[model samples]
Target: MSIRLDLARDSGLTLSDALSVLLPTPAQDLSDLPRTTELVQPFKPFHDHFAAQGFSSVDASDAPCGDVILFVPRAKAQARALVHHACQRASGKIVVDGVKTDGIDSLLKEVRKRVPVEGPISKAHGKIFWFAADADAFSDWALSDMTLAGGYRTVPGVFSSDGIDPASELLIAAMPDRPGARIADLGAGWGYLSSRLLEREGVHSIDLVEADHVALDCARHNISDPRARFHWADALNWAAPEPLDTVVMNPPFHTSRAADPALGRGFIAAAARSLAPSGQLWMVANRHLPYEAALEAHFTRFEELGGDARFKIFNATRPRRRAGAS
Candidate 1:
């Protein structure tokens, strides 16, 4: 790949650099790496994948010393923070890589304003750039902890980082007066729903399942009650330890830039699989998403609770088994 060649030649990343890789995004064919390379990824799903591929992957940036190589995320604020952190932490060069769609060019320009940058080579719909990462430049780009209307803890790169998502708010507002004592908040970003559910009188436990480790980290800060259990996991793949009485979610519907409703459908299927026979799923989505057929495939009953022009919430029950399927 272009990133590999760029690192080997342009960035001067050597085998003995005590390398720490950051936020390595999901990919099918990762190149071979030196045995000492530490793959530092915050997202649970991608971390598991990279680990399974025999790479040394970790969930946090805990390395005592290493040269940092960060894949610039789509979030501009986060990318800046990554570069700044590497500059302060890495003993060797800090290499940055990203695609055009992710604003790599703009990132290069912004980094150049504060420090000397090198070799912004364009390739494979993206760019690769590197710098010496010294002298405390670009420190102010680090983002501070932020809050929404309800004082939920959030960071700039987390999903719906700026505030509580309107879809989740609508789902919460339209919720049944009483959700079951045992509830699961699938795709629970930053624990907004789980924290609110804990406020209900009879909620025995609220399981917050999210895929993004960064968002889950914020959730840990936002939720404090013993009743809230957190799992940094892919909602589509995580199974409930026991059958849950209720499932609640504002399921994510996209991974790439384009809208992919299939993601929401996977959450529906996972919810169906994790629930008791009589369990119900309380969920919300944008008004135009086509989750009705998937809901019909999984649940025998569907009721539209409430909505505005932008969002819709539903309560579905009686998990159904498809014909000729186990």
Candidate 2:
């Protein structure tokens, strides 16, 4: 991103003095951008990361701006939707930057078809380009909330946006008939498990804790039961409002394309901290990832429930107290 910006500046690209908004940027140095720059990051972890650095950050933005810099997400439909939204919100240039793995070449080709594009400066296996904002040219690209087969509401770019995740399905089927009265679904994506858990008897409240703001918004639309509560937060740091009787999850293992088991491990630790002393944890995971050690560290006892070849289920009880923990 810095390379492109430098090249653009060398070639006489001058940004306006008004607000410049950057959407969906990861944790990085932003000293080069104008002080007026605001960040729009829907993912809670990244949003909090920037917020800690004293940058103006928000989960979403609707205000008009002098310019908009978009960091393309992996989802193609989501990338297009962001472009359309950027055009709608920007009064000046619209900068698009993305890595090759994220389909920057394809996005550039598609954008060129709609408007005149300039300076596709390439460096470090990625490309960056800019174009004048023309909202009319990309009107059809605006995306609305999608309705899945079970009447679930979702939007582009969220995890498992297309339909219910198979791993989550496995966990749901493996869950005990009456798991607990007070429960939390850590890393809950769009509340699919929470919705199904609501069907079970003796469920007093189900907290849907998710990091993605967009997914949590969909969860709100899909769930209307009074017992369902939604929280847009990083599950690694989030604590249940009350000591949970049970925690259910198909914890996310990836922050990017590569699988990271540490994310799931963090979820297990967080769940243990949120549960009561005698509380239980019910979780599903991919077959190959190792989480037994983490489970053992956090809980007194754990055993495999049941799962097919692709996924495994575990039920753990008796969260262990830390040495110095009160």
Candidate 3:
């Protein structure tokens, strides 16, 4: 995105007169832009990253701005919704930039059908283009909140937005009737597992830790239980407010299209750190993912709890101390 912006600048595209710019869904800082640029990022780690760099960051923005730079996300519905949102808030030019794999080509084609699109400078397996803001042009692309079975509220771009994940369903069935008292659901996307865990006999309280603010907002609406607590946090680093008697998770295994087992490993380490001395962990994952090593390193005993061919469940106990003094 930085490269595309630099090329655009050299090709006579300018933002000198723009008083303020809104960067929505930016994965990283575009340092060349003005220091006052505001970032609209929902993912907790990215929001925290920009906040620490002295930039004003928010989960969402409705305030009008001089200009807008939208970095497209992978979800097509989400990408179009952001464009519609940008048109509503941008008073000046709206710059759209994204990689081809993120459906930039398709989005550009859609935008051209609505308004006159400017230079589509291609670089880095992506394209960047701009157009004048016209709210009415993209009005039809506006996304509404999604409602799944059992009245679960979700939104575009959240994991399992369409319906309950089959893996989570499998995990729920495999969970004991009385897992524990205090529990933490790491990477608890939209609180499906947490809500079910609340129904279990021994569960007293549950912390729903998720990275996506949008999903967390859905969770807040979907669950009205007083026993539930929501935390917008990176599950890898999130500290449980109290020592947890059990940790249940369907930890995300990737940040991008490619699968990364390390993400799941981090969740395992976090669960180990958050658990009480005798705490147990109940987790589910794809059958092919190699998480046994991570589980062995973090706990004294672990075993497969049986799952269908597509998924696997694990039960682990006796968390181990890290290689350092308490």
What's each prediction's TM-score?
0.93, 0.96, 0.95
Q: Which candidate is the best by TM-score?
A: 2
lDDT-based ranking? 2, 3, 1
Residue-by-residue lDDT tens digits, candidate 3, 1-326:
38887788788776634433343444544665565777888888888777777778888888888788888888899999898988998888888888999999999999999999998999989999999989899998898998889889998899999999999999999988998999999998988999888888978999999999899999999889999999999999999998899999998988878999999999999999999989999999999999999999999999999899999999999899454311
lDDT of 2: 0.87
lDDT measured at residue 107 in model 2 versus the true structure, 0 to 100: 98
Candidate 2's residue-wise lDDT over 1-326, tens digit each?
Answer: 36666677787777776655555555345667665678899899988887777778899988998888888889999999989988999999998888899999999999999999998889778888999999898998898788898999999899988888999999999987898999999988888999999999899999999999999998998999999999999999897899999999999889888999999999999988999988999999999999999998888899998999999999999998453221
Local lDDT at 108 for model 1 = 87
Pairs of residues clashing in candidate 3: none
Q: Predictions ranked by TM-score, top down? A: 2, 3, 1
Residue 319 displacement in candidate 1 (angstroms): 0.7
The lowest-lDDT stretch of 10 consecutive residues in candidate 2 is: 19-28
Candidates in order have lDDT scores of 0.81, 0.87, 0.87
lDDT of 1 by residue, 71-91 (tens): 878988888877877777787
The candidate, 1 or 2, that scores higher on lDDT is 2
